[model samples]
Target: MRRDKDSKAKADRHALLAAAALQDHLARRLRMPGGPAVQPSLEPGAPMTLAQHLNLIPRPPPLLSEDQWSEVHLRSRLRQDSANECVICKEEFQTGAQVLLSCSHTFHRHCLASFERYSRAKTCPLCRAAQYQKRPITDGQDLFRVKCATRIQAAWRGHAARRAYRELRRHNPPKDERLRKKWAAERLQEENDRLLSKMEDEVGDLDSLFAELDASVAKSREVCDAALRPLAARLQQGLLREAEAEAASGRAAGRLALVESDTVAPAVACSGQQHLALQLGRAGLGVSAGLGAVAGAGAAGAAGSGGGEGPAGRPASAAAVDWDAVVARARARGTQDCPICLGHISRRGNEGIAWLSCTHCFHIDCIMAFEAFELASGGTPCCPVCRSGYRRRCFT
Candidate 1:
């Protein structure tokens, strides 16, 4: 009987050990990373494990409950003011068409219904107040709400973006327009002053240039007067000699006319003597005038030579000489063209003939025209062929 009891105890102990070993093995397999999946199939009378029972229990719904929605709806209606606009739709409040949250935020009924169904969290969109309790939401009503909310939210977002942009523009800082204008005026004034200064400098330079030119002209006149003094003295001596020779010639002509009066008839002799006297008188006058002019020119030349006053004046005979006649006489010797007009000298008339001291001849009209052109072009009248300076009277 004791052996029978010992055998029964051993059996019970072995069974306990085996059960413990099986439990240990199952726990190890479950904890392993790559362990094969153990899917136990339960028989009709088998009791479920804790994990299986937990898995079988139903999960709470993801959306807001009917009671919570109804409470939200009731609150929204009570707080709905005609003056207030829906936050989601941005439309004026409709008496029973809006939802007011426990957090004092209001939205359109359709907007709130959609938020509750599609929102990841069961909280107020504005205040973030959580919906703790839940109830079933009907599919038909939720579907309609989601569609309406989608359209409203899109419009609201666009309106918000535009409003924000407008606010930013209105609050922007003003530009310093007055400062910019002041700077522009200052720059203009500075530029004007700079130009004025430059013009003043140019004016001063021109004044100095004119002063120098006047001084140079005065000095050149003195030099010319000094150089002409010797020539004037020679001209005076030549004029005195010519006057003596003319007086002697007049005496000889009167004697010859007297000798001829005896041989010819009394009427013819009287006429010849009268003619001879007239000719002598004219010759004497010419000689006297020429002497007077030479004396005056010599005196002026001598005075200017000492004081460096001005250029010497030409002798009256020199000034009165018919240069055109001399040129015509010279042209008769050779067929020469006028340098200015580039045409052969015309013997028919003296209208266009001009003679220069340098022996160069030109058409009177051409030289006069050229002189006027030269003066207009800021140049002195000079010989066009030789570029030599000549007294302007030479052309006359």
Candidate 2:
């Protein structure tokens, strides 16, 4: 009978604890006056916080520092109204008032300043929305200064890179991998030596040849000058005479104009048409003289002994690439397949078009693949089909 009682007591204790837990859960689901719903305790015997009991506790967001808040206040202070009014206190400007405008609504600077200091809140006190001022990046003199600084930094970096390259070149010698470069350099040096010697020998020969040629040219020039000097002198004399005649004629016209003006006034110019005709004729003569001088200068330039008559530097015509011939050669070399698709060529018309200088052509996808491959190889692209030095226009 005693064992039976003990077992029954233990079962009653467990039943009581289960009942307590159930009561706590039920209390959480039910709301209480002046407070949130209660929550069941995580540890049965532990003390519970009010939030834990109410299940209404929220995770806090990040907090801003006082300095950041001060900056926000400063930005807000920039938008002051003409009539300064305190938004929070609703006071007329009895003292110095700073207005703050955010989201098309104005606020008193002191109101925002107080909230910023005490509340640690980024939201507006009025609407509970995020506070922001119209703080656009200024395109002022400082911006130009910043841009100039960036360019100067870039130039400095370039100069440093070049200096580094030169330093490395000066300090480092050849490695095993650079044997080919060393050999090329040695070979180039020998070639340069030979070329120098050959040039010296040729220079001596050229000097003699040029001396003879110079003498012949000088003699020919002297003969030509002797023959043409008389003609040039006569032409120069004729030009001077023409110029003198023009000056005399202009002076005569000027005199005539003065006489005619003295004879008539603008109000009584009924018979001044003859004088106007003479003035027009003189103006025509002046124009003719200018044209004549221009023509004479052109003729003199052409006839001068200097070789300025020779052609100036003109670009050579680009050599045309024979697409048909290139296609034929590619076909002969058995490279007539699309490299990417590995599809056989159907016909040449518009199936693929080649770049002007290259032997390869392909579908658009193949060209893009070739471009990627070329980028990987870190050099100019080879032909996609035959690995020749060729490229083509790619249009999808």
Candidate 3:
């Protein structure tokens, strides 16, 4: 009786298993595609809504073939003022799978897909237009690019910041006292070395400048010496010649004065005696015994006083010879003009022409040069033209 009960139980278990299998199959068929299949075990929740169903089971995005996408992109290129690159990536369009929005903007498909996945929106990535008609295309071209413009810029900026951080850490002083002192000493030494190098360079430039200036100064001095040598020599020669001329003139003037005094003394005395005899005869007085030895010139004077006679008031044919002698003496000292300067001697103001005892005349400035030369050379000043010893003539 126990065996019979066991067999009946096995049969009942088999029938229950078959019913469970059929129910599982029916449940699998009845559930919506991509919706939750497993029912809650503990408690039944609210029924699934249409929005929830659509959220779970999204529709597949549309795509175009390579030929169709190429034609559209070519058209965009031919259009005036069309963008040549994707704005999101900031990279030129490499022939690839891309998306064209309804707002007329285009982008790399992968880049836009990434943006949509993160933002969870159907809006245009560039224009922000909702309910956009996205036309995804397959261009069958090189599409290796993946980095977006923003991410690339962020990475570069991060790299720079990290590099700066590392440099700052290296430059900053450590906590250890010994190391900090060492760092400070090293920095100080480097700065001192740099300053020393700069100073040396400046000093070198200064030395070069000094050398250049020295060369210029030396060259100028040499040029001056060469140019002035001849002038100095000529001036010295002229000064010596002037001094010698003054000395020679002093000697000549002394000699001429001696000759005039010795040779002409007796003749001048005889003429003075003859003039005294003539004046006495005019007064009917006898000639003196002192004038007796001057009888020869007295007779001549008497003849001269007779005016065109020989002696004793007689008319003389030899009067022509006496007239010629007087004219010859006058001709020896002829001119009224100054000999030193060619200008006529006309007394003007306080500083006028000067006449000498020898009857030579000179302009003041014209004769001053020779006078000054003779004075400076320790010789007596003499007349410039005639080399005669003279004194200033007093008109009064």
- Candidate order by lDDT, decreasing, is 1, 3, 2
Q: How many steric overlaps are in each model, in order?
A: 2, 2, 0
* Total clashes in model 3, counting residue pairs 3 or more apart in sequence or in different chains: 0
Of the two candidates 1 and 3, the one with more favorable lDDT, higher being better, is: 1
RMSD of each: 26.1, 36.8, 31.9
Write model 2 residue lDDT over 1-396, tens digit each, in one string: 999999999999877866665555456646445443544334223345444444443323224455654565555346432134446666543333344334434454666678768888566665666644422222223334666799999999999999998677555655766765885686679789999999999999999997998888579646754554444344334544554565556643432322212212221111122333333345533322222222222222222212222232111111233445756776676665665555554454554432312455565433533343343334444444444333132221
TM-score of each: 0.24, 0.19, 0.26
What is the C-alpha local distance difference test score of candidate 3? Answer: 0.49
Angstrom error of the Cα, residue 310, model 2: value is: 57
Off by over 4 Å in 1: 1-175, 250-396
lDDT of 1 by residue, 1-396 (tens): 999999999999977866665554455436656543453333222344333444432223344455767776566447643245666667655344544454446666687788788886668777776653322223323444666799999999999999998676445533678866665676679799999999999999999998998888679646754554455345435545654565566753542322222212221111222333344345643333322233222222222223322233222322333555645665675747776545566643644455543345666545544553454344555567756443222212
Pairs in steric clash, model 3: none
Considering TM-score, where higher is better, how would the candidates rank from best to worst? 3, 1, 2
- Point out the higher-scoring one by lDDT: 1 or 2: 1
Which of candidates 2 and 3 reaches a greater TM-score?
3
